[model samples]
Target: MRAQEMWKVSDGTGITVAVIDSGVKDVPGLEGRVLPGVSFMEPPVDHPDQKYPPHDDFDGHGTTMTAAIVGDGSAGGPQGLAPGAKVLPIRTSIGTPMAFAVGGEAAKGVRYAADHGAKIVNLSIGDWYSMDKIRSAVEYAQSKGVLVFVAMGNEGEGNNAANPWAMLPGVLGVGAVDENGDPLPSSSHGQDTDLSQMGGKVLVRCKKNSDWCVQDGGTSVATALASASAALVWSAHPDWTANQVARVLIQTAGAPRDGVKRNDYVGYGIARPSQVLLNHAGDPGAPDVDPLAAPAPAKTPTPGAEQTLEPRAESAAAAGLSWQWPTLGAVVAVCLGLGITVMIKRRRRRR
Candidate 1:
C-alpha cells in the first residue's frame, strides 16, 4: 500500500470513525484518541455513555478493530493505518457468544453513530435475518452524509446464509482478500459488495493488553481497514461528501482486467486509496448519485418476510479469513461435552 507515501499525503487527521461492535477499551496506543462511547446492550446498567472499558469483551475483537483503525503505535506499539483518526466506540455486544449472536440492536447503533458526528461507521458483525429496521438505519446514515462499511461475512462455502447488512443500499459491503490481492474463499459475495481489502493475517493490538499484539483477519478486520482507508482519503479531501469518496475509490480500484467493471468475488476490485491521493487518478463523479445503487428507486422488502433468529457467532480463523459453522455432528459433540445444547445456528452470509 506504500503506506508511507499515503501518510505523507494524509494521516486521516480531523476525521472521526465509529466502531460498532463489541466494546473498545482504553489501551496505551489509543490514549487520547478514543472518544466517549455508548453500549446498546441492556443488562449492563452503567454501560451507556461510559468513558472507557465500556463493556465486557474479554475476547478483544472490538479493541482489535479499533486499534487497526486509529492506533498511533505509541512507544513501539502496534500502529494503525490511519493514526490521525479518532475512534468512537459503539458497543452492540458484550463478548459472549450469545451476545454476539444478537442482530436487532445494530440498527440503533448505526443511527447513534451518525447523530454523534462520526464521518464513518464500521460494522464487523453479520446476521442471517435481514430486518427493515437495520436497512432504515443505513438509509438514515447515508442521508446524513455518513459512510457505513459493513462486513460481507466469512463463510468459505458459496452457499452461506443471508446477511441483511450486506444487502442494504447506500452502504459499502466489504469482502476479504489475501496479501497477494486474491479474494479469500471465506469472503462472502453479493450484488451489494462494493470492494475487497487485505483481511488475512493483519497485525493488531490485543484487547486483553495493549502492549501485546496479534495477527488476526476476517471480513470484520477488512471492514475496519477499509474505513481507515476512507479516513485517509476523506481527511485529504475534507470537503468531499461520502458519495465523492466512494466514487473516487470505485473509479481508481484495481480491476482484474483493463476494462472489467465488477464481479461477484471481488466487487469493483481491491481498494487502492494511494492511487487517488498520490497519483490523482480518479473522478469523484456526481455528489448526489450513489455509485452502487440503480438509478431507479429501490424496492423495499415487505415487512414480516421469512426471517428467523440465528444463535451462533462464528470466529474468523487465525490463518485465512474463513470461518466454520459447526456441523450437526459437531454440535452434537459440543452438547455431549458441555452437557447442554447451545442451540445456536450461526449466521453465515456467504450468499
Candidate 2:
C-alpha cells in the first residue's frame, strides 16, 4: 500500500490493534502508541527463571511488529502505515522457542484482545503445529466483529504445507512480497491465504536500543504490514463491520489473476489499501456474511504430513513456496539464486 495515498484519507486513528507476539517496548517511534497488555510467556513455563513483562520485548520481534503497525516516524524512524493507531501488546512467545504450546495462549490472546476493545488482532507468529482450539478462537473473534490476521510461515524451501492457523477458514492468512510486487520465496502458499503485503527487508524498531532500528525479513513482518493496512481501511470506515472491512480489502486488493477468489502464490494479489481508502473501490458486502467461510465439504488434504518443502505425499497439504524482492536493501539471505534452505522447529505434538 502507498503510504502517501493512505495518509490523504485516514491515519488509523481511533483504532486499536492487538499485537500478540513476543512483547512491545516503548521506543521513540512508538512511545505512546503502545498500550499496556498481557504477557503469556513466563517463568516455569515457556522459559525458566525469567518473567516476560507486559511491555518488554524479549527477542525484539514484537517491537518490530509494533513499529510496522503504528510507528510515528519520530527521531528519524520509518513511518508506519497507520501512524496514528494504538497497539495493544500481548506476549505469547519468546523469539523462536516453542516453550509453551502456541494453541492455548493464542486462543486466550485473541479473546482477551477482542474483549479489551481491540478491533483487529495481528498474529505475526506461527509454527508447524495444528490446533483446533486456535480455530475456535478465530471464529469467536470474527463473531465478535474483530479481524484477525495471521502470517503464512516462511518455509518455502521445501514446498512446505500451510501452517494450521494459516489454513483456518475465518482467519486472514497473509503472504509476503518484495518491493517490485513479486512473491517472496519464503512465503508459504495455501487455500487459506487471503492477501499479500510487504514482508522482506522491512525497517522496524529494534529492542536492544530504543533509538536504533533494524532490517528484518519474514512472513511475520508481512502480517504486521497487512494488519496495519487493515487499520487504515477500518479506521476510515468506522461504521463498517469486520465482514465489510474484509470484503472491501479482498475486492480492492491489487494483482488480478485468472481466479477472482484466491491465488496460491500471491493470495488474491497484493493488498492496496489506498484503493479502498481514496477510490472507494470495494464493496463491503453483507455485514453478517463471512467472505472467507469455506464452501460445502469436499475432499481435502490430510492435516498432518511430512513437514518438508519438497514434493510431498498426495495426502499432504498442497501449498508451495516461492521467492522475489527488489528495492529492499536487506533481503532475506535464504533467497539464493536457484538454491534452497530448510528451517524446521519441533512442536510438542502434530495436529
Per-candidate TM equals: 0.78, 0.78
Worst ten-residue run, lDDT, model 2?
317-326
RMSD of each: 10.3, 11.0
Error of 1 at 215 (Å): 4.1
Which residue pairs in candidate 2 have backbone atoms (N, alpha carbon, C) closer than 3 angstroms, thus clashing? Answer: 158-309, 158-310, 159-309, 185-322, 185-323
Candidate 2 backbone overlaps, count? 5
| Residue 322 local lDDT, model 1 | 28
The per-model lDDT (C-alpha) reads 0.66, 0.65
Put down candidate 1 lDDT per residue, 111-217, tens digits, no spaces.
99999989999887755432456767877888789988888777535443324466666777787776566666667665556777777765554535344544547
lDDT of 2 at 309: 20
Best by TM-score: 2
